[model samples]
Target: MDIKFESKEAERQYLKERLAAGFRIFAKYGFDEGPAGHISLRDPINPDAFWVVNPFGLHFALIKASDLILVDESGKVLEGGANRHLNLAAFMIHSAIHTARPDVNCAAHAHSLYGRTFCTLGKSLDITTQDSCAFYNDHVLYENFRGVVLDEEEGIAITQALGDKKAALLQNHGLLTTGGTVEETVFWFLSLDRCCHSQLLADAAAAGTGGATKKIGDKEAMDTWKVVGSRKGGHFAGRALFDLIEVETKGDYKN
Candidate 1:
């Protein structure tokens, strides 16, 4: 179950700690490719106006709650990072996502190894397993790569492609996942990469067998999705991941 905060201050602190913990968890999974990945959370007090992100070029493994910076939609640093530089791509992409989807409060994107490899296929994940069913009809493919995402136009285009989906595969790029909470977003991203890894392995084995991969029927996938794909189901799974990370890191992610 989700914890309830007595005040906005307490809620803000929780968000920061979870956001930083997310980075640490990603680092443990070898998801950090220099500064190529970013995960952000909308500030509890300023949900539409401001969000928290890591300083540009900082290693995700070394991220701490004190290292997060608050930025507005215009990319202005509001607090906590006067000396640190904001990742402009974060501003362009997250700002657009936060604006486009009021329900999404946290977003995670990374150039994870398997995610990029699977993105080359330019298709959604095949739901042949119970875990993959969580994203059965809840993901999309962003076919337009358009080089690096530096401009506002590119960010908006990506968000438009995302629509109401929980995850997206950026062709020739990587994976992007969004959720109402940091835990859910991180869980989806991690799970997405694992699914991609499984698919890649299956494809390789199938190539040798001269057979094609079998897909689960849509009706069954949809039925399983209702149980595992809902926000509540995601939160239930994400809570376990957050707990494991906290134990592994000795709770040092908290400031």
Candidate 2:
């Protein structure tokens, strides 16, 4: 499972492939809500800029490595043709995080059904299951919800709320996750969305039973997180998903 690159070009190609795989995988899991979701990977050669899918009418499932567009921190398209345009919200949210956190090479956000539903509750996930334990103390809940985030100031506020956390559940919005690699970031996004779904189900069942749900203690939850919440763990999960999607899609995303 070691990733050894002989050259920068090799690394860039790997990043691009993984990025495209991420989009396709997201689409597979119903993460694409129209053109609302975005995943951005920082360029290996240029840290100030990132590669993202172009804002065309293409669905995420149809996105390929060639469909990606390179954009600078100022939201200017640097590689894609004249027809390509960057999503303003995507640029605002992703650029703010990339600029504020150099260690974050990738950031992902989406209006996933479960994630969006959980955001409306205005509460962080409780440690109800081992999967939910991954975010026991590692996630935050952003309380601000001022409509669609079209302004840089709102983006900066979201960035501030996400400080030092692996995932943030934006109130009335959706989920955002960051990582040192695109693989890790994608895995976190998937994991957090599932956690939201699990929590909602648990809460509903508890209410039906007229009983309270039990949670893992902080010490135990933290220990569990050490195993499942690590970047290496996330990368492994991402690899598994990528392999599954590759077979299902016949590797079309690599085109």
TM-score of each: 0.96, 0.96
* C-alpha lDDT of residue 130 in model 2: 92
Look at candidate 2 and give me any clashing residue pairs: none
Q: Which number leads on lDDT?
A: 2
Candidate 1 global lDDT: 0.87
Candidate 1 lDDT by residue in tens digits, 172-233: 99999999888889999999999999999998999999998888999999999999888877
Candidate 1 Cα outliers beyond 4 Å, as residue runs: none
Give one digit per residue, the lDDT tens place, for model 2 in 1-255: 378999987887788888999999899999998889899999988889999887565699988888888889888888853458778888899999999998899999999999999999999988889988778778899998998889999999999999988899999999999998878898899999998998899899999999979989889999999999887888887788888988998988887
Which pairs clash in model 1? none
Candidate 2 off by > 4 Å: none
Residue-pair clashes per prediction, in order, are: 0, 0
